[model samples]
Target: MRQPALITFAVLCLPFLLHSVAARAQPEPQSTGSDSDIAITDFSKPSSPGRTFAARTVINAPVQKLCGILLDYPEYPAFMPNTDNASVIQAADDFAIVNMTLKLPLGKIKKYRLRLEPRNTPQTCHLSWKQVPWEDLKADDTIADTSGYWHLVPHPANPARTVVDYFVYADPGYVPFGFRWIVDILSKESLPKTLESLRARAAELP
Candidate 1:
């Protein structure tokens, strides 16, 4: 009777012992590791101009390098998805004005001007842009209004990595009938693609 009871107890404890060992062998997660980059897109929040869109990711490159790539407005068409042309009309140490033309879904062309500012601190780098009026370009012909910012921070666990956050508020005033899908494409679907584009661009650079 004693032998049978001891065998039953051993069998019950074996699984728990194995699980404890497995847990102990597992490695601790890095603070800002690529595994923690979990991409998230939220459009549930309502805003005055358009729906709010926010997404985040981790890039393998350092923050400084990514900041440089973002400030290079003229090179946007080469890597930025749906961008047809980007012309910087004004440039200065603190800000830049860029005219961007985009080829949207169904072959529609949208053109707008944006005033971009790059802000930097010891801990983070940020690039914010808002649509501005161009005398020749009418509001009705282009996007109603748009504003967004990209925030970059260095990874705490790794010096060579960066965490990036992207936020967008866009109001495409009047989308042609049956082309309402463009709104979703711009906000929801494009978020991850935007991160991927930036990551690829950084990898391509020396």
Candidate 2:
């Protein structure tokens, strides 16, 4: 079942729905440690009416290594919070189709498939994606489709260290998004936890 744009837009455009807030508030650093400094921001600002938001950090790993970690879908549940399991059902050098099951903050478990496309260049690599149809999921109808990106840009002076950005835009169809409490709780769990875990993983790798 296709989700209506109104609901998706409403959830995305929450802060700007009435345009009451003029400037988007930057999120404080979620955690700080010797491995890396991780920061998350609400890119879905009042300046722009969209669902996209980003998590950023600087790691002691090279861009290539970082990309490899991101593509290792099967390991997500180990580090990323709320993610129950993830597997790459199909993949090639340039693209991959992954199946994921996640437990939302409110204890709602949903499954979906994503088609990931990677773009590579000499110094930078980025992956962008959208939902895909997958028969094994048995979840397309109940859960809303979602999309986002992962960006890796290496430090010019320190090539071995890289700056990473993770963006996620989701719409939980028919879910009670209007409940600010649920939104607040899930917000604290999802992206922030993912970045924290990712930073730890990158630092631990040799």
Candidate 3:
């Protein structure tokens, strides 16, 4: 009887162990743990092959308020830092195609177009995107590739608050091999400021 219960317990715990292993295998960038407001993490290594980041914040605003901010695709540069321009090429109630030009720290301009899909529920919305080849440049001309999602989850206990999460992966295409460190440094240095700016902007919204 004892042996059977022990085996059953072990079997029940396997999935959790696997989850911990997987999380450790792809360790998120280290950061100060969050309390209730905002926390951010970004992978920044001089020799790393790609850039990835995730940010989480609590905003004292409703989901629809942030939904409007995100879907106003053409005005992204007005509030999103380092973005020089954004244009919505096609649009619908639930999706859009957008083009963006990014002014890199080294001053190279990278342009890419992406498809965005918005999924909304009663109190939450998720906006996700992936890069697509555009006419002005080949797939290799801009940053190599990118994909990400922004999720707004209403706080379970606080009806007036929402938890916002942004996750992104970016690969630089035209970046010079020797100077990739510049990109790494900039990504790390800029992410916190970007999150702060977003928090400030959202807080200002009605």
Among the numbered candidates, top lDDT falls to 1
Top-scoring candidate (TM-score) = 1
For model 1, where is the 10-residue window of minimal lDDT? 26-35
lDDT of each prediction vs. the true structure? 0.82, 0.70, 0.74
lDDT of 2 at 99: 84
List all candidate RMSDs to the true structure: 12.1, 12.8, 4.0
lDDT of 2 by residue, 13-124 (tens): 8967456554334333344453256666664555532345567777778899888888787988877777788889899988888888877654567778889999978788
The CA lDDT at 102 in model 3 is 74
- What C-alpha lDDT, on a 0 to 100 scale, does residue 23 get in candidate 3? 78
- Model 3, 1-206: lDDT tens digits are 69999999999999999999997885343444553545667654668666878767777777778777887888778778778899998999878899998776656666889999999898888999998878778654477777888888777878677777777777765566676754554345455666666667778876
Error of model 1, residue 31, in angstroms: 12
Ranking by TM-score: 1, 3, 2
Runs of candidate 2 with Cα error greater than 4 angstroms are 1-36, 45-50, 135-142, 177-189
| Model 3 TM-score, 2 decimals | 0.75
Better of 2 and 3 by TM-score: 3
Q: Flag regions of model 1 displaced more than 4 Å.
A: 1-38
Residue 188 error, candidate 3, Å? 4.1
